[model samples]
Target: MRLKVLTCLVAVAALYAPQASAGSKIRVETRTYDVTGASGIELIQNINRKGPKRGFMAHAIALTAYSASWDLVMLRRNGSCRVRQANGTMDLVFTFPRVVSPMSPALKRRWSRFMAGTHAHEATHGRLARDMMRAAERSAVGLETTDDPSCSKARREAGRRIEAVSAQYEAKQKAFDVTEHRGGGHVEHLVLALIKP
Candidate 1:
């Protein structure tokens, strides 16, 4: 009976081994950036309101945009960005302060500016991450063959694309700095911003 069980195990392993070998190994890392302040909640809320088309929101707009385009998973709040490596994952956390009242229209305008800038900044990181994963995936496949000029060329092209996209995103995000109060204030307005990727 023991021999039969062992044989069955071996058979199962053999049957699944090829498929497992063909599948690429995936690892994920996340990084969080905190944008804390008295207007942090309002900032996040405004950013979320921009949606995907605006190209300035963090959740679905930035995360989904990159993930869908680059074949990477934009994990929500501690979600993982899967890579074809075993080096675990990176987590990025962004913290911000609470909102207070006495917010004037002028303050709201400033908040809007802040949100737009923050979204642009975070989107750059997202783009970089996506590019990195794509490069890794290509490397995994490229290492297997020798004298495959086509594959090598493709990999090189992919690298260039990644670099270009990363630079563009980074430049856009870094262009604006947060110019507002950091903390301290009473809760005049409470906007519940959903915690998502």
Candidate 2:
């Protein structure tokens, strides 16, 4: 029920600490949304309607959006250019429905379990995003180009390396989704619990 949106942002022009001494750093940003309804079932239905759509499925109990960007600083010395700093950042926005107030003990218990399961799944996706960002940063680090006229060649190579890393991680994310969301998987179990309770 919790789905994640991934965005790969363009290079940003910002001064970051030198990578030679400081190494790479990753920044994570997060946001949350709340939806409310009269009861738990209503809450679920409302959230499903309001959540983001993926492919043909328009209903989701929760959703997470992850946007990542990187800044690469190049240093030129002695007719050679090298990546001096690689800084990566990611933003994770999680949207979920609020548990209805004044619920019966049984309903409250089920709601609690549902929230826990959904959050856990979304957190895993967030972790994967962060990991991919870090990998991209590492790939961008230390890239060099000896082309004399301009560093465009080096820049292009660095971009390709970073993109390759990102693509590989993206494939991993898809594979994980397929495994985790297969029939009778973790997500299905969570949904069944919420509805059958």
Candidate that would win on lDDT:
2
- Report the CA-based lDDT of candidate 1 relative to the real structure: 0.32
Candidate 1, residues 81-190: lDDT per residue as tens digits?
11222111222222222234455565566656544544554544545444544444444332222343233433343344444544454444333212111132111122
| TM-score to true structure, per model | 0.33, 0.80
TM-score for candidate 1, residues paired by index? 0.33
User: Model 2: clashing residue pairs?
Assistant: none
Cα deviation at 6, candidate 2, in Å, is: 6.8
RMSD of each: 17.5, 3.5
Off by over 4 Å in 1: 1-16, 20-98, 145-197
* Candidate 2 Cα misplacement greater than 4 A, ranges: 1-41, 55-57
Backbone clashes, each candidate: 19, 0
Look at candidate 2 and tell me the lDDT of residue 139: 81
lDDT of all predictions: 0.32, 0.66
